[model samples]
Target: MHTTQTFRHVSYLWDEAKALELAGNEVDLFIYRSNLLGADLRLTNYAGGNTSVKITETDPLTGQPVEVMWVKGSGGDIGTLTKAGCANLYVDRLKALKNRYRGLEFEDEMVELFNHCLFDPKCAAPSIDTPLHGLLPYKHIDHLHPDALIAIAASKDGETIMKEIWGDQLAWIPWQRPGFDLGLQLEKAVTDNPNLRGIILGGHGLFTWGSTSYESYINTLEVIEQASEYLNANYGKKRAVFGGQKLENTDAETRKARAAELIPTLRGLASSYRRMLGHFTDDARVLEFVNSNDLDKLAPLGTSCPDHFLRTKIRPLVLEPADTLILKSAEELKTYLVEQFEAYRADYAAYYERCKHDNSPAMRDPNPVVILWPQVGMFTFSKDKQTARVASEFYINAINVMKGAEAVSEYVGLPEQEAFDIEYWLLEEAKLQRMPKPKSLSGRIAFVTGGTGGIGKAICEVLLQNGACVVAADRDRLDDVQTELRRQYGKDSTITAAIDVTSTDVIAESLKQSALQFGGVDIVVNCAGLSISKPLADHTEKDWDILQDVLVKGQFLVTQKAVEILRKQKLDGDIVNIASKNALFAGPNNVGYGTAKAAQLHMSRLLAAELGPEKIRVNTVNPDAVLRGSKIWESGWAEGRAKAYGIAMEDLPAHYAKRTLLNEEILPEDIAKAVLVFVDGSLGKSTGNVLNVDGGVAVAFVR
Candidate 1:
């Protein structure tokens, strides 16, 4: 509640026209749109930050030069800003002295300052720190909480913590209130250190200002880049042991039991918040954290940043129940409210009174944002769609950071009252009611073979959006696939396994591990088949064996093993085989591949016949010319096959395209979706059928 405010002159202000001129000539947004040479710059180079410019114009009525500030609004990362994201504010009004502030209360001053603000009236409230940006004297200013700054801020004793690493080059400040106070503090710090390149606010973020917007933005990134490099080199080993321990314990039964208990609570929370959130409970981090011994200690540590309190309450409700019933959970929450808050009932009433506006409904029940049951895990609550999503993201990120911190040291979170203060802050509360609408397939599960391949990877993304847990398996040990999947789907929702599909043992193990991790598997898309382009005369015994093993034998092995679990669970499961157009029509030098694919087609028919009684459908998707960037293309299979057929590889694709009525290059994903149709139960009674996903390549040819 300290209320001292200060301002500084940047000493290099430019007019609006000059600002626009600078933006047009040097901003990457203009460059990217103009198809200019700098478009290839890394997209993240300037993300999660903002740039602003000040324009002074004479008000026709007032006879005064009114300074209007144009600042980048929220939602976009600064590195990727375009023209539309810049918000225009009444700068002169923003910088105006408080009318009755000579002896005004803090709350009154805040109310008055907020009332006169005229920026992005339609959007959620302008950033809470708008006052900080207004007071900077520079025409253009840039700010970023880059990963490097977060790394330093996240550490214990971050000021002394950073000094050991950054030397004396970087300036540091203790954490403080972000708006008028932060701006004033920064002004003083800069004055004290006139040559200061940047300021790092311990536990808050980083700020870099300059004569122009671009220089400030670039310098912020450069400073963060240096910090990142230093951190990577110096303190990177801090969590190595913890990470290793977590990984080593991944498959332990104790971990699984803990995970199972947590999943139901998470699922209940997700289901309750279904309208507002995307797929939330299925993320791997949630799964992993719930199963850990430190979940109770970990959950709160991972909550959203100070800004996230409005969307999610300060801390999720931790339901350490002796029983698993919802009634018990409710009782536990009530008890916790009393135990945790000295004047729980009064505070709840006061909170509602403060937040309720003229027509706004009474605040929803004072349930916790998330709940952690004893053996059952955690649950998150939201009255509507947007709050749920915000809660979910906040929870996920918080848990991840906490888990990460726990690896290096004990993760003691911010005091509960402080968290409450931030969560109830007016600016943050608005975000809680603005959660994103839920997505389709918000909590389904999918298993994909060849997920490391481009086509398979694309399909995985589509399934993820539709709310499916994805298990991506590949024959190669490309850990990059796992890393990328985790990046997109959260570690829990995506599981990667290395398996040679031809080996029944490997397939069985992979299936077992997946079932154990995700309760059960619902959809299976078989994309593990391979082909060898070799003429009938030149086809070696070894080549034929390899082709038959992967394309034919492997398919049978995987399907047979998964069938038992699918049937036992009574899940009307679907299986889609990636067949080849060559299975229907001959392609020169594809003697071994074509024969194996034909065998796979026949096998799909036989499996359909056998499994139909159990309501487990089987089908095949035959695709042609899906060789782009695949092993087939990279290894010159299409070129070799075309050469044997006295044609060019480029012409080979066209020849197949013309054979098909649509004349399109059949992508591997096209085949995957056709397989998905059967897996998704779209083909109700259409088991054992071969769906041509080859863009009509097989239409002209008769069996």
Candidate 2:
């Protein structure tokens, strides 16, 4: 239930919107308000809702008044919307499409008409629902899928309830598949009720309009409040409690741990892509819903609206004997999940055949996007974490909405046929088909050591950009690394852990947790290292022990544990260890660093030989003097190098950059590139090899 305080904490920046309005940028003010509506997860999620504004401008070329509709671009999320996020279209052209769209049903011709209506050829594709806004007369229009309103909209007695509250403030439009026809129907309703402030689409969502963005936004908020207050007062008693206890006795740590154990198995089963990531939630409300007796009955009723079908599927998959899954071995759990996946596929195919019609598109990938298990709570999977996170939030709200609706009356969803239509709607399907293909390393997961350092961070960034989920592990500064990565990629694409490379127990646990959380690891970059440059005769025993612990022993522990998980997944994997150039060409006063790296290099060869039968490739990347962004070089280590070479400290960088035949300044990105070459199998046939990232250093060249 939404408390008053909770609703008060909206993300809307009212002051910013006012400033924009005062500056004569009313379109920007509307965009800002739309972003606020999108940012509030309680109001809408992902790209669920859209907003638009009608502006009058004098055409310079024609010297005539022109009205333009700036609507949200297709596939653009309102949460991150901007001026460019909207598609500009000539209003007259869009309104004229009605004549061309003479058919009763929307088809390729309607799609072509929408494309031709674009004012700018290079503008983003307009939303499928652009016609809905185009036909409306208001200057500002807002559309949202708020859970509170959805609960009321999806109920059988919803229309009666609305009449009892607000008699004719909102015009009622019965359900119709959204397209040219639906927009015309809405326009007729508006004509029929000229005084109406908003329109409620049965089993769909609400549309509010006004002369200003603020008025439209507030109108939507008031409706949500009415729905929320009604549910809390009349349907409060129906709230489900987890395990029949007021609260679960376990703490947060315990819940996540237990959930993590089941994640890998769930991911392996629910995976539709080659590699799918899991976003687990042990949230109190989520746990309560999953553990409640009503879950099986209420959950599969379908989403509150048709728009959600693309991400959450029609329903969430329920796993039984959840208690047994907790105690089962990885292999046993995996086998059971595989069986469940097959059964699910068969069931989905049957449903498709039963509900599909002539205009229906082909069956989409039949895989469960959300899965519910008792002891483990819920796990949502998508192509990436951002998608999964949104799905998780949506389902959580669905549970709340269903509970409220069930209390009001027997909760009923749209019929199976309606669901099939929306899920495979031509407009949505065409947009998806038009999207570019995934990157080369899409759906792959990688675990990198020393992720807070330069080389490690570079590896994480490049991998994320190329479409891999990264688990960045470090001894310290893990939180900082996590924040930076999330900012760069997204919250779901990168996860971080505090791992002491010297501690076997810590390394083992980190690897296991990462594999479970991120599906499984396919590439492991063993890059954690620290070098102590000193004369061999003067180096203390303690210095040598620390070097060996991190470079040689630490590399072995991480790879050994990660490899075990990868092999169990039965997928070919790669292990690329970061060695130093001194490993191949030991320079003066570099004994401790050189010896440890040499050991790491040889160990890679041995591991390659041992794991070759399993198709696990192991290799080494030996980088030299990558000082531009290296923490090791920044910590006065370059001064030591300068002393050893008998040169000025200020001249060290140039000396190293120009020392190589190529005279290029080696960087962390350069080392990361070499690492990927081996991991991506550009050298697919070769293993037990050392690739150098130095700028053609003749002395450091391998024989």
Candidate 3:
């Protein structure tokens, strides 16, 4: 028997002093309040909630006091909402839109009018839910998607239960796609009730407000706390969840390993147009739901909350029952996935056709955004790590809501027609259109060896600039590289790990890191190497062995390990090996280094031929005399090569440049660009090739 769990209250984080500090201005207090409310994932998922404060500001043109409203803007998260992120609009102009509103059918037009109401023309764009805050009569208002309140709102007996908990303290409204009509409905409810503190939108979320920011903030917390009390009192004691657990969870490590093995394939299929990054989570709550007998039934019902649906899609595709999943072979799982993908796409298209309006933007991506494997975990894929992570969190929110709702009354998703209406809404289409275009390598993940070294670091930088999630794997100096990349690109775009390419075990760990951090790897760059130049008679046994180990063997092992992830994706992948111009030029006193480079060059060609059927292209960038930002040069290669030429150490760069047909200095950035060419989708048909970034070394050129 499951014991009743204690009611955990939403943290009351309100500090009176903090509010008082910002009380002089409504906008400041509103931003403050929004930050507090948005800080808790329990309060609202990323960008799911909106906050507004109707304030008095001086008109820039008229120099007179004007009533303005600031609401969290379209696609802005309240947790990080700044003044720049809030849409500032004239109140009179917003109310003026009411005259233009034809009916619920034409509510989308209201969004266009909101821009005209902007107090500043460059202010943030307003969302469709703007009127839900603007047209309201309160000075401060919040539209939040608290899981507890959404649980009640999504339940079969939601409104009835609300009446029981707060009686006349809160009002109820049936589910309505947020627009002018719903805002008016809200306005009327508050106008008529006169005694209600908040309103719960059926199968949607919650609405709370007060005369001041503090009051509104407190009201939101109080209402959620009250809902928690009621739900916890009834949840475990009332009935079994998701028809109760039907499968034992695989251990956490096993679940993660399975996800790592599986997501690459799913990710490739999902990336029909643009590749997606993945985030995996095995929150106990999610595992419970995944292990439950009702997973198949409930996951397909999708999420009731619009925000949840927007992140998680209308429904999740459950792969198999937890207990019997391991019994199936990997090939069986893969075959099943392909069939399901085709079926899901067709089904999504049908959904769009059934619900699309004549003016609806053409159907969006039909691939599933959320996938569930019984007893394994929930996996979400998006264009970047942060978005993927947020989606996963939102689905977990959906799970919590479902658990509480099923504990009392059956949990119900938004009606299919209603769900379609919200999904294909023109207002949302505009939001999607307004987003900045993706970079060249958006959603692609790359693992860079020696990522802290000069050439490796340059490659990582270029890849990150092009929007690839980079795992900068190096045996040393990872902390500095990770901090620099995080500072430059934010936490979502890059991660660094300490790894040795020579060890298969270490290489496997790097790929696992990539899988967990940003889905799977699509691009692999072999740049970890050292150079040893000496007369054949002077080269020691240790010198030859070390060069081969680090240069030839390391590159081989790195590519060998990453090929597993690439193969799993069942998609196109790129491996660029950094050999050297010396591989072909036969420079004097370079036996140890030249031999390793020659071996690397041929190995790349062999891998290219072997992996061609899998769409894994192998290529090489042979950089000659790359002295600028080179660790090999810093150690001894520059002096050794200079000695071979009977020239000063400082004279080697100019000597190499003068020797090339183009007489150009080959920088690390130049070599980095070469690595990019092989994977940037430009040379799709070209592979088993060598690009000499030697500034035109005629002697090193391939025949």
Error of 1 at 115 (Å): 12
Clashing pairs in 3: none
Give lDDT for model 1: 0.57
Candidate 1, 499-551: lDDT as tens digits: 78888878866775555455345567777766678777878999999989887
- Report per-prediction Cα RMSD to one decimal: 11.7, 3.4, 3.8
Candidates sorted by TM-score, best first: 3, 2, 1
Q: Where does the lowest 10-residue lDDT sum fall in candidate 3?
A: 1-10
* lDDT winner, 1 or 2: 2
List the candidates' TM-scores in order: 0.51, 0.91, 0.94
lDDT of 3 by residue, 552-668 (tens): 899989988899889888778899999999888898999999999999999999999999988889999999888887889889888888899999998988998999999998898
Q: Return the clash pairs for model 2, or none.
A: none
Q: Where does model 1 exceed 4 Å of error?
A: 1-65, 70-72, 76-86, 95-125, 131-305, 308-447, 451-499, 503-523, 532-544, 556-575, 581-595, 598-619, 625-630, 633-690, 695-703
Q: Which stretches of candidate 2 lie over 4 Å from their true place?
A: 1-13, 16-23, 238-249, 329-331, 356-362, 476-480, 512-517, 635-663, 697-703
Ranking by lDDT: 3, 2, 1
Count clashes in each candidate, considering only residues at least 3 apart in sequence or on different chains. Answer: 22, 0, 0
Q: What's the alpha carbon RMSD for model 3?
A: 3.8
